[model samples]
Target: MTKSGNVLQKINNNYDELSERYNFTILPRSTRWNSVNRLGFSSTYLIRQGRVIEAIEVAELYTEYQPKSWQAYESLAKAFEANEDNLQALKNVKIAVRLVDNEVNKSLLLAYINQGDRVNMQLRSVKSLTLICLMLFLMVLTACNNDSKLDFDAFVEKKLTDFLIEENAQVASIAIVNDKLNYQKQFGEFPDGTKPHHDTVYEIASITKTYTGLLLAKAVVDKKVQLDEDIRVYLQDGDYQNLQHLGKPITLRHLATHRSGLPQDFAYTSADIKSGKAFELFSNYSEAKFFEDLAQYQLTSMPGETFQYSNVGANLTGYILENVYNQPLSTLVAQLITEQSGEEHTRFRLEPSEISKITRGVDRNGKIAPLLSPHSFAEGGLTSTAASIADYMQYLLSTQAEEVLLSRTLLTETSSEHGHAFFWNTYEYHSANPMFYHSGGSIGTSTWLALYPKQKLGIFIATNVSANNTQGKLNDIANAIVEKYEQVGQSK
Candidate 1:
């Protein structure tokens, strides 16, 4: 490891210890300033230590801790540029450019602006050359120029159609580019010939974990919770007495990264699932019951010693946040994500008017399926439209929300090649600049969220029907779309 990497690892190792030592009894303005400076120092240290993703994450935390500081925004912009997210880099630098009064930093920001402009100019030139070549080819091969105009709309439509046909079902897809949603399409139809509308909602199973992750990051920003603190602190003294793994208490970070060693579900039996009633299985599952079962649970390994995907772990984090914020998970999600991002159609509990927009899931045999309720609300209970999910994704792509959402926080060797964030899994698409993604599946529905932070690009897909290979289909579609954009960029 590089010297920077060594320092970063050391920071990670001592993070909890230092937090407990210094900020345990966080007081008034002075302590808050001290906390902000500590975060700023960490952010700068990551940058100097050459940990790009970690730097970006901590830089974002610094900005949240001190939003008015032009220096903080400037630092964040540099981090974005270092990560090759030139668009966001330019955006932040421009903000910093306006905020700074002194000439020194202003000149530095202007230099970054100029460099960004040069890259944009090259891209524009490539696009123009591509258009010229296409025109020339069409004119020369009038007999065989099969519409080489690169109609992104048609390309996406065909991909969706092929995917739905392969799965033998129906799907809803929305595509966003440059922060604006430009395409909305539906494939196949219900038995009643009811086509999906723009507002069609689907149960976005594990994608709900991303919302929980957001709430966790938000709670940290609000200073209501800390990532490294043992979650037992939030519960009553004896509620989770049996929750520790060999003497190590599970922290929120472990839970979010799926290394808490907690099991994937409650002790609910197969009989509970066979009951054919949603509430009977989990809808009304109470937090008290959750702790009751947790008190009897055993760990497979010590906390943070292994990567074990755990729905119950995420649910427990949500429960802890509820304890800290004194609000339901639904309300916290609305406040932190949906309302904040203007995603009007995403919620755990839907209003009466919005109920009709739900695209009921279909089984493998093409029959309408029963709704699914997971072990807890935080596990897999949120519903959203392609547009609404796209809106939330747009917020992420915009880099206007929490940077923790996009940061490469964990280095676990998951099925995905890159790593994992809180709930988002990272994949190596075309470069070291890995793409972040998360897919969800319930009884009869599937959803996917993917973004290339470096490119400031993303795609959202939600389908009402679930098949054995739906996740593969979603991956294929997302990859194809990203490749299409890369091709366009290369053409320019």
Candidate 2:
């Protein structure tokens, strides 16, 4: 075995021993060369040895072994912090603080909690500093070397290439659309070293939500359903009295805006998802099983009052739409979206012959991951090519259809700069120059789509490697492209 593989195996063995002893409980005060202690020491040693990736792996394994232990979470948080993943560090530390029972432990965890704000401030400060430095460096480079200035296309290619290398990603497909440009490109290759083309297929994942939102808008425009109508009215299977909280029934709008007061998934917790049990359950999941779970689901808050991203809610919305239209989601998407957009290769279902065009995806651990199949069609499960997405972006950019407009209208505003429009996230809300965006992730793919309505600009990026930070990296790439495009426009 390779050196890294040996290290991973040792970590796994330590975790297994730890799990056998603790059994997912809080760690005791006394620790003397126990499995936990060994594992923790191993992680720390890795970090000290400048192996932050392996340190993170060990810490992640420890957390998975002892999920309820504050110490495990704290270790994971520190590992992430050392790796400069402040967002994940903050998240894990917050969970550690919540899980800590004793006052002494709580006090120790509170220090990390206090650092969250400092981390955020530092991130903002670093971004500002980086921007200033970049501008200054660019100015100097332009003065010194006239040929150093990169065009928008070259800038995108270089940035995406760097991103792929840094993220250890296999493939990236991107599209940018506007009045002056319709651009699409694919970078990197499959595990077999075969290069992808513009028409190479990829799972768009939750970007499918935007299409579902548009379908909902179409239903409203056609007078088939009311946004505020009780969703229970359409559910014909069982009496779901537990669906409502404080007498507020979940509305279609609530589902679209992720305010439906539903659990994130139908039958699994976060732990189950991390352990791959949720995916196993989803493999054989049927419509009947979905409704069965829904009937038993109790609302955590009043519908439309709280925002919680719920795959179950999204799927339920799709099911309701299916019932309203007397057609499947695949058909509705074909009729309303792909056909209208002239996205010939975009669909929920692909023919057997076309499946080969779908590029393979790699997981964070460098293993080939299974291609996601359609389960919740509305929440995710759409496949398309960069060229097809480019065409779709152009359609969205130019179309003045009522449904499209309604889909872009703000449904819920969380702040002056942020809001939800149907299923799309609206940024720069109060500024009138709204940008609609959404990110998508399946087991092994990540995607981001952004639309600047006033500017008539659209950007879509996708990678065949899904990691914790993949979507953020894609967002960064998209933003860089936009900045370069704007700069080019200003210069002209």
Candidate 3:
């Protein structure tokens, strides 16, 4: 057998393992293939040993396990042909041909099926062998094309270098697969010309929203907050009495999903947010001021009327969560996310040693931006190392500790058409697998994190300089990684 076939055989060798141990495993027993996952291997093995009845039974089980799998249908067709069930064999082979993705593969299988003389089928088996060889050749060529087009490590290095020249960014990024750190790289350096290590930290601006969303999901599971219930109960009555519009109160769901009908930001003007004073302004921006703004402000539409991106709404959600848990948002976040995800260096506030590892953010003009003050502790305020973020992402994609990770509950779609899940966005297309993503930007930094859970893939990119078009750049990098990930994973 060839290397790829050997890999598939090894996967079949470990077929009886439980689902939770699926990290980095070649073939995760997908939901549809759960019942007779390795039966294809067993059926082929048994058919060669002249165990026709046993092979037929196993092949039938394989078909039931994944009715849509063209391979399973084709295997069953072969088993039927071995058993002299020519009519059943023809029916199954036709179905297999119909279900195939590639036209070439389908045509080859159809030609193999049209050879009706079972007496000379062994001679025709040479055609089947040739078809397999051609199919494998095509797959190799396709994989090579995808690799050249979507070399993720190369793309990140190139993009980071471009940012260094164009945006003057000091950037670091990493990719994780199957709970292991696969790529760790950096470009440029701190203004003082210090090289960044794997432990170097960066501000993950609105990317903090996904962490906040995870907290909300955990709160629901803990019965600390009801997802669909109004958040007014957690807020002081006087502070939220006028928050409603036409008697419609915003729920916790509305706030997390950006449908809370709140404004995008506070009154922090450019003048107030001077280089070093931004943190002071954010910290001193009082609860009283927040309520006063809400009291005076008018809602143009009712809560949940539409999707409006709102930093205020997310921060308020964090604040209410603090109230409900009777703990600081920082502490709650540490316990709920950072600790659970095994991200030792990720937190809302960094200690002095942790601070030493962080790169200083440079403004677009190349001036060192003001270091974030302690008050910017929620919403867009998060500092984390690339390695830790990669580990956290792997933790999210892994099946282990799923109840605490809350991947399933968090991914329940609020808008299937739009593919919004909590604060994460999902990409839905016929040919593409689903992915969950979120991006963040602060004055001097930007970050994007995403997961293709089905493929057990995750990527994180962060830069010290906030570029003019960071989002577009992040999207391109992410798409490239996803394409590469799917190609490699599918081949395995």
Listed per candidate, the RMSD to the true structure in angstroms reads 14.7, 24.7, 12.3
lDDT score for residue 20 of model 3:
25
Q: How do the residues 1-492 of candidate 1 rate in per-residue lDDT, one tens digit apiece?
A: 222223434444676774553331232324323545566566556666677787787677666644445777877877776676766765665566545533445555454444443223122454445533543443354223223323555677888888777777765665554332234566777768878776777888888988888788778777888788888888764756666867888888888889888877774555665665543656566777788888888876888888877889988888888899999998888766765455767887545555555567787677786666333388788888776776677666664444344333553555646566776677774365677788898878888888777666767788877877787788888788768756544212
Q: All models: lDDT? A: 0.67, 0.75, 0.66
Task: Provide the lDDT at 330 for model 3.
Answer: 86
Note the clash tally of each candidate.
2, 0, 1
In model 3, the runs with Cα more than 4 Å from the true position are: 1-156, 179-181, 237-239, 269-280, 350-357, 400-417, 429-432, 488-491
Judged by TM-score, which candidate is best?
2
Candidate with maximal lDDT: 2
The C-alpha TM-scores of every prediction are: 0.65, 0.68, 0.63
Candidate number that wins on lDDT, 2 or 3:
2
Q: List the residue pairs that clash in candidate 2.
A: none
Which 10 consecutive residues of model 3 have the lowest summed lDDT? 18-27
lDDT value, residue 455 of candidate 1: 69
Per-residue lDDT of candidate 3, residues 222-322 (tens digit): 78888778777878656566667898888887887777888876746556655555556675777678767866767778987787888888888888888
